[model samples]
Target: MRRRGPTRLGRAAALALAAVIVVTGCTAEPPPPEPQPGRLVGAPAPLDVTEVYLQQRIAAMTLREKLAALVMVHVPGTDAARIRSVLDRYGFGGVIIMGDNVGGPARTVAGLTGALSSEAGLPVLTAIDQEGGIVRRLREDDAAAARELRGLPASAAEQAFRTRAALVAEAGVLINFGIVADVTPDSSSFIRSRTLGESPSAAAERVAAAVRGELGTVLSTLKHFPGHGASPDDSHISIPRSSIGMRAWRATHAVPFRAGIEAGAPLVMMGHLQFDRISPLPASLSPTWVTILRQQLGFDGVIVTDDLLMLQRSGLPEYENPLRNAIRALAAGNDIVLFVLPADPGSVGVDLTGLLDALERAVGDGRLVEARIDASLHRVLSLRRAASGLVEPYVDCGPKCWGESPRSLALADVPPTG
Candidate 1:
């Protein structure tokens, strides 16, 4: 079949269309630059990279996911299956291993961490209260030097803690609840033996060195904030009262906390001690103290409660209910409330699940705002993200996220290495 050629009018029309395209500069925008090879499509970026990404991750999560990030539950066993059941069900930010959880096996913890972390969406921080000396959890390690901070020089103390941290890190543990910053001079002080010891100056130096020793690998924690040694009353039994005034506190007690903060410790566990003169409430449940920790001392990291169960141990009218205490702690600006329920003598017979249930009801009832959950989750996620290597130290502090702290990476968006 013969094909018909374009007529004069058709050719003229085609020429006119070509001229119009050239004049108007219409060209399909160069095929989007050949699809940009090596670009990461849906690869997870750092949580602090953008506010939208962080929020999206937060939004994508269920209430359980958010709650899991907020609490570190203790499942007391070296049995990998029991631990895996908890992690698989809750997706908790961490698992706090007590002395019982650390059986004599060299690789029990490492094996547990590997098994659980492989199934987790984020890094599951392997936690231990390795205070060394009397409170050492990993006694199997010959190099455990938690008690060595008692009288060692700052340089020596730093080396001791750094060595301790390396040994712990080798077990795949990412967090340490050591470095007691409390300075109590009393011989009978409960935490005295576990602390950096008598001199505030020396305590501060030793605490900061220990913090710096871990650098980015392990998240160092300075615990029992606002100093616990001042009160002879045991917080584990009841809410201890610190009779010291704010002026006295500033001069002495606040010293080690300040130094640890300056050294960039990622977590601070607030004590249940009440500074009656300065603040009427327990430090763990007191907004006044939390504010002091944040604004006055400049601790921008995660502030966790010592144990709601301890405050409940007082059996005082205000401290009885674990559910109420969790609410009060959250309302008081605490990012995490440690409820060692069921295991805590004070928490006997109480449902460990009640904490999350109460929090969920509170959020649903508007007693707690979703934003509050988000803010708490942001700090929580930031810590997890930082610890997981998805973000850098204090990523929210710089120009990223516009100086606002937003620490979360979309699990799907994060690169494979993390």
Candidate 2:
């Protein structure tokens, strides 16, 4: 049996095919190059860089600093330097710019906030109550507020919040205590004018739409949780009381909060409202309400208290102490305790040193568990990280980009170094 070689024609065809293969090898698109270590071509870097960053940052904080970070204070003034000095002196994690703080336009306000935070990696949470309508701190926000949006469609609520959030962000504020998730049908109710909807269902739709509109511009907050519409009284002066049970609440007031959480709101503010049947204490100081908010409503974001100063303004003997209210709020699962202070904080019985000392004592005496404080700190710090855009997937500029090397620069401040 003899093995035969190719014919002349077959040999010529083989040679032509080989030449074609060489030509294709040179001209055709190359296979995706092997992934280079420390180089992110179109691929996303680890998403947990932000989480690691938060954990490391929190781990380095002292007990006093951690407690201070949980408090967001307000100093009434237009002087950026003075406010920043107060923040720096207290080493607070955040500040709320009030009507007095906005001395002029947005650019001027930016200077105030810009001074509040020098670290771009993790900026201090500068917040403002720019709810438009009656509650706005910035007069430049001419967007449709709850008063007008309530009459319009859900899309109108989205558009209005979009415009409002942009104004807040333009002022260099990171958090906007703008969205009023409360609902009430009473035309005489105090919060009626600032509510997005008269009915629960209507409010839910609009609240969700508003959150969607504020998705990327700034951190959106849903206020007066358990709903301010629970009572006709104003929380600023009186502790509003309601008797609505969990069943009735779920069917009515909880509708908007649930919808807002689902729509990705980053913060929920516990109001100083009391539902006696549920808890004798106000929601801001009620563990029952916090449990319900976390377990029942399924909200996992940061929970802050409405102005602690309001508790003192209630004129009640028990609620007169700001330090006590802060401890209770933190112990009850609130991540942040807010204080809106006048130039004279002593006039309202709020001494920053005394408050911090009380918190330190609470932690030492086991009145407020250190673990609970850590949990709240984690949530607050995580929110700050996300708000700063640190949690977004990282991308490498490859070898062609300018400035510092992306990998080295990103890793320089990142955590899990061990």
State each candidate's clash count: 5, 0
lDDT of 1 at 317: 81
Residue-level lDDT tens digits of model 2 in 121-186: 667898999889899988988889887888899999999899988888889999999888999887
Q: Worst lDDT window (10 residues) for model 2?
A: 396-405
Q: List the residue pairs that clash in candidate 1.
A: 43-413, 44-413, 44-414, 47-408, 132-146
Candidate 1 least-lDDT 10 residues: 400-409
Clashes of 1: 5
Question: Candidate 2 vs. truth: CA RMSD?
Answer: 12.6
Per-residue lDDT tens digits of candidate 1, residues 310-365? 76668798777878777778878888777553544443424556667887887788
CA lDDT for candidate 1: 0.72
- RMSD list, candidates in order: 13.7, 12.6
| Cα-based lDDT for every prediction | 0.72, 0.83
Flag regions of model 1 displaced more than 4 Å: 1-53, 118-121, 142-148, 341-349, 390-418
Off by over 4 Å in 2: 1-47, 389-418
Could you tell me every candidate's TM-score relative to the true structure?
A: 0.78, 0.83
Q: Please report the TM-score between candidate 2 and the true structure.
A: 0.83
